[model samples]
Target chain A: MSGFFKSSIGRKYAMALSAFFLMFFLLQHFAINILSVFSPDAFNEASHFMGTFWAVQYVLQPVLIFGVMYHFIMGFILEIKNRNARVAKYAKNNGAANSSWMSRNMIYSGLAILAFLVLHFIDFWLPEISTKYIQGDMSGLLADSEGFRYYEELTHKFVNPLRVGAYVIAFVFLSLHLTHGFSSAFQSSGVSSMRKEKLQIFGKVYAIAIPLGFIAIALFHHFNH
Target chain B: MNLTLKIWRQIDANDKGKMVDYKVTEISEHMSFLEMMDVLNEQLVNTGEEPVAFDHDCREGICGMCSMYINGEAHGPDRGVTTCQLHMRMFKDGDTITIEPFRAKAFPVIKDLVVDRSAFDRIQHAGGYISVNTSGNTQDANATLISKHAADEAMDAATCIGCGACVASCKNASAMLFVGAKVSQYALLPQGQVEAADRVKNMVAQMDLEGFGNCTNTGACEIECPKGISLENIARMNRELLKANV
Candidate 1:
């Protein structure tokens, strides 16, 4: 019902849904990117398919963009409303006494991730869009050589130490963001209590492993480039 | 015990409040926190000064009327206890303790250390009870056999004293734990089945209208709750709402 979506719990439910979508997208994206570390040819093949496939390009990409935007916009609205809930703040709130620092500071970590997203978009997404759509180059080929453009471009981007440092830091923030967010999404989605402990354990593993994998990729390309 | 207290002072709701320092000496370590406050109030009355105003009813902690943010925590440093039940022995001698009223847009300050928690009453009014005729036609006891687990869960949920500590301790000032407890106490029982959907919908709508924040699942509420209410109640409420909407 329309009333459900308009309620506070409804808004949080929407947020959790979007978060799940984005998190799933991150997993698939990481899966493809990590291939570059193992085998550049496989990564190139996968990237080429994902880049040129009509369903992925037209349908999934747009949905992915919408999901990311929805999560951020809803997050901001919730943050503002929550801030307004307390007109006056306590002189001393020992948040660490009752909750984890990561849980208390989701907005800050989200902002950090958002900043990293801007950099990421500029570094990779923009160029990919410009090349494929604006320049009308569907061929996943390098102009200078006879090899696939995906792997070379991926390696080239990580050659800069500063960029790699920024990326590593961003992945760390992403890890922190996931530390609380992973299980929280399920909780918001109305998961039962019996499975919560297992979800938490799994959430911890995914939260740390995925970002650590991404960091390894960045460091690998940076050092081995 | 000798203690310095920095307690919030406000004459009325509209007035801006500030912390005023007072020293109390020769206080017994076994004195309850409210008794310590009473001692300070006695001192103030002797000097022709207005004493700090606070809310308290049953000193046994069952009433949930005593609310204070002591040393930056709801219900003070002690776990599973309300402010009235917090003993002075928890603090060391010569310590300076800060006392504050619960702060939330929904829970406005009526006076020093007292907030208007009638918003909770409004939410309760929305749908916290089940309506049944009791004009000499009440059902016999044990008419409906409920599972012991279900009864236990319902009783656990019912243990909530309507204290606003969950909201006070929450970083976002969310009332989900309180509402969740209220909803679960009904949802787990067969008597609450008839209007379960309407109850969740209306209560949540009223909760939003009251300007309480949404739950972010930080679990501070469970930790700070005097009755040890679980976050499972919240998840159950979420499920009930989802089911109601569908």
Candidate 2:
């Protein structure tokens, strides 16, 4: 395992596998949220279902959290290791000042995304799990007058301009993160075939589309209300 | 054309460097950037001042020796050409050009604009070669029948002169583009396939071990590369590394 981690291929494989887990989670989360735009009933049902699912709450949630934590830790560890290794060997002045802004600020972007995630969990997931599971306060204004909860809460939040704007800003950052992350994820995974060109195009489209989708939902609710 | 040069000056690797201003009144527009520097050095010599030291051997741009950060660019403002090939015509009269050595922790200053890029040589030494011995009676030249497409791609990758421009042009001082070119050149060729996994693994490890930064796929290195080596090479190397890891 140490030898594999030291090897380029090993590092790439680790990156790819971690990326796969994150992407899978993103897709699932997006799909679930997107339902709110079409049918509140569907979203509420799905949210309740997810909330009640013991397997997800116990087994999958821990795994997902582990994936997120490991991904963050390993990414930094690898970057630092690579950096230290480079400094040890060469002491040459080769011009590298002209490179792109994104290349230089990847760590910063990642940190921004991580910070967004923390806030996101606080805003939504914390209240969600705390109110539902911990306190069992499936009480007043939590569920709508019609006994619907998730959709009502989402629409209420979207009605507020500040909340909607925050969501939009978060989505924008997500798009920026994805723009770099998408291509890099593939490179890390070692998947650059002729298919790479296609993947890059797909990655860009996905980067734009997912964020746009979230923006669309937010704007739709913001405006319709 | 008359030009004012603000060149970085340092006596040794340990000395603090600064930009020293110099003037050259007569320079031919046809002269390369380095040739123009040569004219400035000649003027400095005539005035009993020390010549501005910069690296340049093959003014033809193939030696990978001419590394300069001119006016905030890796090899001046030119694209796909070394500083040795950059002509004076690109500059107008009265241009105050700021010339500095490439800055990276991995690439320390030697004197003036010169830097010690022997790290690249060491990284290459790690695994950038085939293990076959060069015997007097080796196999014929056509022993390997590589496809035209692969051969062309390999040749394109092989064009990297190890000038360290990729590192200089990169924001993180990442050598991904340079190492990618070397890895892809060998990986594409049948002669290099036997050790493809080992080659990529070793080279990339050596690259990181040398303190180069990570590639962010920024595409600046591609644009600034004197050889125009593609970022696809990086993607290719990444793919190879993934497979090797798996």
| Candidate 1 lDDT over residue span B177-225, tens digit each | 9999999999999999999999999999999999998899999999999
Model 2's chain B TM-score? 0.97
Best by lDDT: 1
lDDT of 2 by residue, A173-223 (tens): 778777877777776665655777888798889889988898898898889
Off by over 4 Å in 1: none
RMSD, one per candidate, in order? 0.7, 3.5
Best by DockQ: 1
Tell me the docking grade of candidate 1. Answer: high
State the RMSD for candidate 2. Answer: 3.5
CAPRI quality level assigned to candidate 2 from its DockQ score: acceptable
Candidate 1 lDDT score relative to the true structure:
0.94
Tell the DockQ for candidate 2.
Answer: 0.37
**Span of 10 residues, lowest total lDDT, candidate 2 chain B:** B209-218
Candidate 2 global CA lDDT score: 0.79
